[model samples]
Target: MNSKLLARIKVDAYCDKHLFYGLTNLNDGFDDSRIKYFSEKDFEVVLERVKSLGIGIFGIEPWKNGHYYDCKVYESHTSDPTDATWYMTCFENFKKRGDNIVYAASYFIPKKLLSE
Candidate 1:
């Protein structure tokens, strides 16, 4: 991801504090590792590196208060509120876009609080 994009994502994640913590807990330890691994500068460098590797990048932007986005990239609510599994299923559509490089933005939330 580019530094600008990464910063935007971090800002967005920070805005949704509860969801950010919930997502971090869901991913075990990856959330913290990701924060440490991707400094703003590193994100910019990775973007250039991936491009040089001939990989196309795809980003999934979360819709405020929405569970998922439509196949056309529009945000929508899932038919079943009880099953949040739709969140993962939505990725299947992106997977069909042909393999290059697929990085999901939701993967970046941090685990421990900053003071920790």
Candidate 2:
């Protein structure tokens, strides 16, 4: 990782917070509660990192309040809410990312993903 890049890299704007890449214990409560958000200086940097790793981001999930990302009105929902594991099934491929991320952004990136 470039020192200059690290210096400018804030937290990922998608997840509630920037989590150190790892297998976290997602409790049974609200999924949002298990998330921690982070700040970012350049979305490009984040995009490059994600693309390099070929990360597949499923769609965002609505919170307990029925509000979508950023607490927006729940006029509609992302993917099917029926299956507990069906959330984040829709893959969102970004051509480019912005410096600041907001709205429709409860995106969660696992620290590391491994295939069995």
Candidate 3:
């Protein structure tokens, strides 16, 4: 099985000091908890490197504390509040008219429970 990491770039406007706001794979394998956030430039470099390894990378930007404008959200069978999944839907020049676009967003699947 191939390993995948779904990560999010930190957005200062959407962070709370009491919570972890650093870049990390919602799954395991990668966690940068020491830093509260990552600069866009640094995230870009990391994206390329992870992609080269055949691992997927997603950017996340949670808006209004409940919506993810760049990806799709999915729910799991577990009753646990933390059990959920999401897939990256990052797009550029979205729509044929080139009217919409979203950035710095990603999806989450608790504990890597889902598969490719």
Query: What C-alpha RMSD separates each model from the true structure?
Result: 15.2, 13.7, 12.8
TM-score of each: 0.26, 0.28, 0.27
Decoy 1 TM-score against native: 0.26
- Candidate 3 structure lDDT: 0.30
Candidate 2: lDDT over CA atoms?
A: 0.32
Better of 1 and 3 by TM-score: 3
Q: Ten consecutive residues with minimal summed lDDT in candidate 1?
A: 65-74
lDDT by residue for model 2 (33-99), tens: 4343222323333333444544423333322233333332112443422322222222122213322
Candidate 2 Cα errors over 4 Å, as ranges: 1-33, 42-44, 60-113
Report the C-alpha lDDT of model 3 over 5-116, residue by residue, as the tens digit: 2222222222222122344323121333422223344334433433333333233432222233333222322332232122212322122324322223332223332322
In candidate 1, position 79 carries an lDDT of: 44
